[model samples]
Target: MIYAILTEAQNKQEKQPDMADTVDSSIAVAGLKAAIRVASHGSFLRAAISMGVSQSQLSRRVAGLESRLGQKLFHRHGRGVALTDFGQRIMPRVQSLIAELEAFDALVSDTRAQLSGDVTVGVIPLVSRHLASSLVRRLQSTHPGIRLRMLEAYSGQVEEWLSSGRVDIGVFNRYGGARPVYADPLMRGQVSVIGTPDHPLFRQKDIPFNVLQAIPIAMPARPNSLTDHILGAAANHGISLNIALEAGTSSLIQEAMLASGLLTLSPAGTYVKAISNNQLTARHLCSPSVQQTTWIATSRQHPLTAASRAVEKFIKEILYTSTQ
Candidate 1:
C-alpha cells in the first residue's frame, strides 16, 4: 500500500511539475539538509560549525524536521548521535535527491563564470607531496578563484572522508580488492626495491619478491598502505620479512636506508630524486610486480561543486597524460 501510494505520488509529481509545490518544499529542503549535515558530522555542534550556524539553531531545525515526520531521527549520546532506523532508511534517498538538485543548479549556472569555491581533496600519505605540488601549481595558474585543501591521510581515513561526505574527491591505493564506492583508476603506483649503490643488490635490474625475506630492510610502521601490502604479500608468500628498522615516518625510513645498507621498498616517486643523485639504486619488483592501482574516489552522496569538478577534470587529464 505504501509503495503504491509513493509510486502514484511520484507519477503525479513527474507529470504536474508545479512551481508552487517547489516553493512549498523550500522549508522541507532546508530541514533535510540541516538533518543531513548533522548526521554526516555525527555531532550537532560540529555540523553547526561547519554550516556556519549555531548549535541551538541546528537542533531546532532537526527538531522541526522530526516533528514534521513524526519520527525520531537520532539516538543522541553525550558525544554524538547516530541515525535512528527510520532516519537510516531515508537519509540516502534524501542525500541523492539533494545531490541531483545541486547538479541541476550547477548545470544551469553561468557557463563562463569563474569557478570559486572550497574543495577538500584527501590523498594517501605516500602520494601527498607529489600530487599536492602538481595540483596546487596547476590550480593556482588556471583556476585562481578555487581554494583547494589537500588532506594527507591513510587510505582508511580517506575512505571514511568519502563515506561521511567530508571530502570533495580523494585518492587511494587500490589493494586487497575493489572498494564499494565510485572510483576512477588514475594510474598504477610503481613499487621499487631500493638500496644504496654500495650494496650487493645495487646492480640488479629486477628484484624478486621472495628475496625480501632475506634482505635487511627499513619499512613503514603500522597504519600505512605500503606496510599493509607488504605484510599481506609476506603472509601469502609464506615468508617472514627481515624488517631491521620500523619507522613511523618515511623520512626516518629513508634515513635508515641511507645510513645503513638497508634495502627498502618504496613508490617510484619516493626515491626518484635520490636515485638520480647517485645515492640509491632501484629496480622494479618482478615475479608479479609489487604495484598498487591508484584511484580517484568520490562520494555518491553529494554532487561535485564547480571547483571540485574543475579539479577532478584537471587531475584526470594529468594522470592520463602521465600514463601516456
Candidate 2:
C-alpha cells in the first residue's frame, strides 16, 4: 500500500522482507474466526456444523493459522482437541478482536440489518440440558448468521438477566402478573418422578404424590419453582414428603439418584431421550398432575436487535415443536 510516489525503484524490492507478514495479515481474519469457533465449541466438527461450513474448510483455516504462527495451536487426542499453550496465550486477544469486529459491523450496519449479531440467552438448567444441542442445530441450520451465547441458570437468575438487560432472551415460567418482560408461551412440560426402569413404580400409569415417601425420592431444595409446587401440593394432601436429599440443581438431583440408587423428581422433558435409551423413567403424578408453562421472553425495558428477534422466533418454534 502506498500513499505517494516512491523516490526510487529500489523501494519496491525492499518490500520483499515484509511480503510474508503482509500475506499472514491478509489470511489472519478468516483463520482467527475459524480458530475461535473451534475453541468455543471444543470440537472442530461441531464448530463447522454450527458455522454452516465444511469441516475440511475449517480445518484448513486453522492449519494455515498455525503455519503462519509457526506453532501448534491445538493438541489432538481421542476425545477431542484442546488449545495448546501458545493458543491459550493468544485466545483472549483473539476473542477481544472478534468482539470488536462484531461491534464495528453492528455500528456500520445501523438500521439496515444483515441479521448478523450475537445474542446472550438465559435458559433454565433442565431446559438447557435437554434441548441445547438441538436448539443450536436449529439455529445453525435456519439462521446461520446469528451467533448464540447461552447462559444456563435457575428461573430466578434467568428472570433477573432479562430484567436487567444482561441477556437478550430467556426461557422462563409464563404466569405472573405485571411482569417486567414480554413473554410468549412456549409449551407446558410435566413435573415428574424420575426413576430407573427396574423400579416397581414404573408399572403404575400415574403415580400419586402420596407414594413419594414410599420410595424415598429426592426433591429439589426449597426456593425453587418445582419444590414449591410439590410442597404446596403435599401440604394440601395432608402428606409430608420424607425428603432423602435436598439437591441444589436438577442435574445434581438426577446424579444423586443415579449414584445412590435413589429416586428423584424432575421435569418430564429433561430425560426424554434417556427414557427411550432405558437410562431413566419420568412418571407424572396423578393426584396433582403438575406441569410448568414455559415462555420465550425478552425484556420490555431492553429493545431487541434484529438478530435477537430472529433468535427469539427460532427459540419459540423449536421449543413448542419439540415438546409435541
Candidate 3:
C-alpha cells in the first residue's frame, strides 16, 4: 500500500503544469488591475464598484502598489483619477499581461469543461473582412467560450505584427514567394483583370498586358505588397503598368475602377459576386495567370494556448472541407 501511494505521488510530480500554472505575477495583478480600473473609469467609486471592492480597499491596493513600485500610478483629482506618466508608460504592458492572464483563465475553464479558449488573430483588412469572419463566426458558435480577437490591419502591417508577437494567427497572401516561419495553405486563387462593366476593355475576351498597361490603373505600392506582387508579375512579362492611384482599401480600388474605367488586378474572390451582378467584369489574368496562395501563419516559437490551438484546428478543418 505504501509503495502504491509512492507511485501515485511520483505520477503527480511528473505531470506538467497546465494553464493555471502560468499567470501574471500575483503581487502585480492586484494593484495593476486596480490602477487600470481607476484610470479607465476615472471615479474611485465607479472603479471600486467595477472591481467589486470598496473605495477604501481600492485606494489601499493602489497605494500599496505605488509603495512597492516606488512611484505613484495615478494622479488623484477631486472626484476622479488619471494615470501618471509612469502609469501611462506601463499601461500597455499591463493590459497585454492582463489580457493574457484572462485568456489563460478562460483556457483553464475550457479545459475543465472540455471546451476551447480565446485566440487573437491578426489579419489584413481584405482577408479579415471577407474571408476570416465566417471562420471566426463558425468557431464561436461551435466552441462556445472560445474568444476571438480579430485585428484588422494592412497586409504588410499584419506580417510585421505577426513577427512581433502581437497576434497568434494571421491570414494573408504570400507576397514575393517569401515563406512565413510557419504556414498552412488556407486557400489559393488566381488574380483577375477587373474593369468597369461599361469600360472599352470589357468588350475583349482578354487583353494583352501591353494593352492593359496603356490604360491608367490603380495598384498597390512596394515592399512585399499584394499590389506589388501583381505589378511585378506584369513587369516580368515585359509589360509596363501605368498606375494612376495607389489606394489603401479594396472598396476604394474597386470604386476607382468603376468610376474611371481603370484596370486593377484582384483575386478571383474579390470580384465573385460583383462580377456575377454585372457590377464589374473579371477575367483570369493569365498568359500565364497571376496566382497567389493565401496562408494561415502562426509563430512556431510562441506556442498557442490550448484553446487557441483548438480553434485554429477547427478553422483549418472547416476551410479545408469547404475547398474539398
Candidate 4:
C-alpha cells in the first residue's frame, strides 16, 4: 500500500509542473473582496473600517486567501499596505468581477422598479373608505403591473399590523396629540358629531363639547384611542358623555346613531360620502374641539419594496387631495 501511495504521489507531481501555482477550490468571495478593498484603500486599517470589520479580521482573511493561492497579495508596513507584484497583476480581474456583480445587482433592481409584485397596506376605516377606491384607480392607471392587498381596521389594529410586519404601509389616525415620532403627518381633520340629517345639531355649523352631555351618543367601545380621547376631553371639561351604546366598529355606531337618533363621534373623512349624500350630517365638535391627524407610516420590521413604495405614493396623493 505504501509503494502504491508513493507511485501515485510521483505521478501527481509529474503531471503538475508547479503545485504552488494551483489555487485551492475553497477560496471565498469575501476574501477576494477584502483583498480588493485593502488594495483600493492602500491601508489595512482604512479598509477594515470601511468594511465594518476589525483590522485583524481583515488581515486574517487576506492571509487565508494568500495561502489558498500560494502567493502573498499585500506588503504590510507601518505606513500602510501595498499590493504585491502578483496582486497588481490580478487585481484588475478581481475588480472586473466586482463590477459585474454590481451590474447584475442593478439589473435586478431595475426589474423590481417595474413595480410588478404584491404590496400590502394597513389602513384605518376612516381613510380606507375613500382611499381604497382612489388608490386602486390610481395604481391601476399608472402602476398597472402591481398587485395590491389592503387590510382595513381601526387605528390600534393597523398599528399592530405595521409593527408585526403584517403590512408594508400603514395609514391611521392619531387623536388630539402631536404626531408620533416615526410617522409622517398627512393631514389634520376635525372630529365631528355625526347623526342623521334631521338632527337639530345640523342647524349649527359646529357644536360645543359640553353639548355632548345632554345628547345620547353611540361610540366605539373602550380600549380605543379615539374613544379614550373623547372620554378624557369630556372629563377635563366637566362634561359627562351620555355614551348610550358602545359598539366595536364605526359602521355599527353609525347604524345605532341612525336608528336610535344617537350621535356618534367621528373624523370628517369617515362620513364624507354619507354627508354628501344627505344621509348623515357632521358638525365639528368645538369649544375645545377634538382633532385627529392622519399619518402615513412604514414599519421598521418590514422594509418597503418597489411595489410597496409605489402604492404608498398613490395613497399619499389620494389622501392629500382629500385635505385640499
TM-score of each: 0.62, 0.59, 0.61, 0.64
Which residue pairs collide, candidate 4? none
- lDDT tens digits, residue span 46-145, model 1: 8887666789988988887788788989998878999999999988887877676655555545354778989999887566776778888998998798
Better of 3 and 4 by TM-score: 4
Q: Where is model 1 more than 4 Å wrong at Cα?
A: 1-107, 110-113, 176-180, 300-303
Model 3 residue 25 lDDT?
Answer: 34
Q: Which lDDT value does model 3 have at 274?
A: 66
lDDT of 3 by residue, 226-320 (tens): 77777777778887778898877667877887787887877746556667788888776657566677777774437777667776776677666
lDDT of 4 by residue, 1-324 (tens): 212322333344335534432233223456778899899889988888766679999988888878767888989788898988999988888777656654554456656456688888998888886888898888888879898889887887888888898999998888987556457788887899899989887898889998778688887777677888899889999998888898877788777877878898888667677778888888889999988988998876855776776787788888888779
- On residues 173-278, what C-alpha lDDT tens digit does candidate 2 reach at each position? 5322323224667777667778887788879887888887556777766666667777777898887877788876667866776677678766666656667788
Model 3 lowest lDDT segment of ten: 1-10
Evaluated with TM-score, which candidate comes out highest? 4
Rank candidates by lDDT, best first: 4, 1, 2, 3
Q: Candidate 2: misplaced stretches above 4 Å?
A: 1-111, 129-131, 138-145, 174-181
TM-score of model 4 vs. true structure: 0.64
Compare candidates 1 and 2 on lDDT and give the better one. Answer: 1
lDDT at residue 71 of model 2 (Cα atoms) = 85
